[model samples]
Target: MHLILLLSGLSFQFSHGLQPQFVFFQTPKTWSEAQNICREQCFDLATTHDMREMETLLEVVKDKYDDAVWIGLSKGKTRRWRWSLADDDFYKEGERSYLLWRSITDDNCAVFSNGKLNMYSCETNKYSVCFDATKQGADQYILNTQRMVWTAARDFCRAHYTDLTSLRNDAEYQIVQQVANGSEVYVGLFRDPWEWSDQTDSSFRYWNPDMLVRTDSTQTCVAMLKVNSGKWGDRACTETHPFVCNCIVKKLSFIKLRISPQDSMLDLSNPSVQADILEQMSQKLRSYNKTAGFHLKWRKQSDGRVFTKEP
Candidate 1:
């Protein structure tokens, strides 16, 4: 009996040592940004898939002092309790322990205490941990559309595409608007009238203050004009003139300086060589800006070559 007990202790120690050490850190980031950081900088969101893993985490962090940390669980977009880390179907016919309170009310946020689960406000501060995983590149688009509408155009885009093409910045919006020649297209803009189908209680609705539902039934879709126009108006979805499609293009930039045989170092005085360098630099700048037609001029400097936009 004594020998068996000792062997069991040794096995436990071996297993614990093999487990990966979880690193903890505190960050002031939105829930989405925090999740993105985990994927881009650290790893995938920490997944407490089983009681054993949960228990292991609890034991490891039981004594460590820290505020609650965000986890992968959340009140999903539809207000359903879900594991935001993956899209796999959650099984419901499990033992009570398996159904342990990993998810809470539809508060849109979650946290972890040591390994225990807690639901919290998204704005609350907390430490977070992530597991190891590879980062995937953003998807790129080829041909895209840009359009404007009354309200109908906006609805049409929503019904057709995945979602109104979301623009992250002004530059992107400007590019799309320019391509579409100021035509309005539907975006993700919606008012309080829009109802989420998955919400358990249908009594309440989410609304964006900037956008309000129009009284006119014809104003179903939303449209935009210039990049600065932040307001949205509802219109019919059937009328199609021009539309905007958010396109992502992969770009690469390389800067090379060449040295002539006569010079011990790079030749900065050679006008021809300087021109070539400027052309390459211009091309790179255009790539970053996602511009198609642009001209560049090269100027010779004492140390290197300089590239500038051509007038």
Candidate 2:
């Protein structure tokens, strides 16, 4: 299903079953500079999550520029599979395994059974293994007997235990799998295409076999060479080039809340009170910030009045 997300004043549509639209700027800059510009103007440097996105990126920049453009891909240090749970301090180096499916379907979720990891649709219903830190020994993997989708499983785990079980090693995986009782269970072992920047765990990669040779010691950042069939290759981070950027947005929900203050003597038309309310709302918004953050805005009335007083 598609959803709309609000980032400050910007909005973008994204859905599991839809191909996202891409916009390009012809401005030339280094990879870092291009990323800054994109985040400021669009979203971030274009993230080609799949072949469809790559094809769209190519078509979007076909006539916009004659040179290569910088996408979000880069060869950064410590390539790994980040867990759905964002607690970095929980899992240490060498504790997590890097496994991914070499398939074209954008199934960003993972399930493990029979000692194998497979990518599955996020919406698929299945049992889940939740990591209970409070439990001792291998009793941590709490298998939910009730079947639910991955998102629902995650929510259940978070509400009841820690989260979807994040295995530290093969021993841990085997234990969690046993908790599944021969049934495939969802684990936090999914691969995302976010390789370098943001480590989005997105496995989506578009590389030209001819241009993928790592020869130069200094070339680390990646740029899509338009002359080379939009193939990505490593380049010095200092190199200047016209880059392509993709606007990444989350599906945010807009909620309207009408506040009715009970004060009789206070002036409802006062601008200071409105400013103070907005300021307080901004602070509250900070608490709701997550991987997909939320923002606060005034829901103006037909007459352009943001606040209305009812007697």
Q: lDDT tens string, model 1, 18-67?
A: 22333433443433444455444333233332334434444544433232
- Judging by TM-score against the true structure, name the best candidate: 2
List the lowest-lDDT window of 10 residues for candidate 2. 1-10
Distance from true position, residue 285, model 2, in Å?
15
Q: Pick the candidate with the highest lDDT.
A: 2
What ranges in model 1 sit over 4 Å off? 1-21, 27-29, 79-311
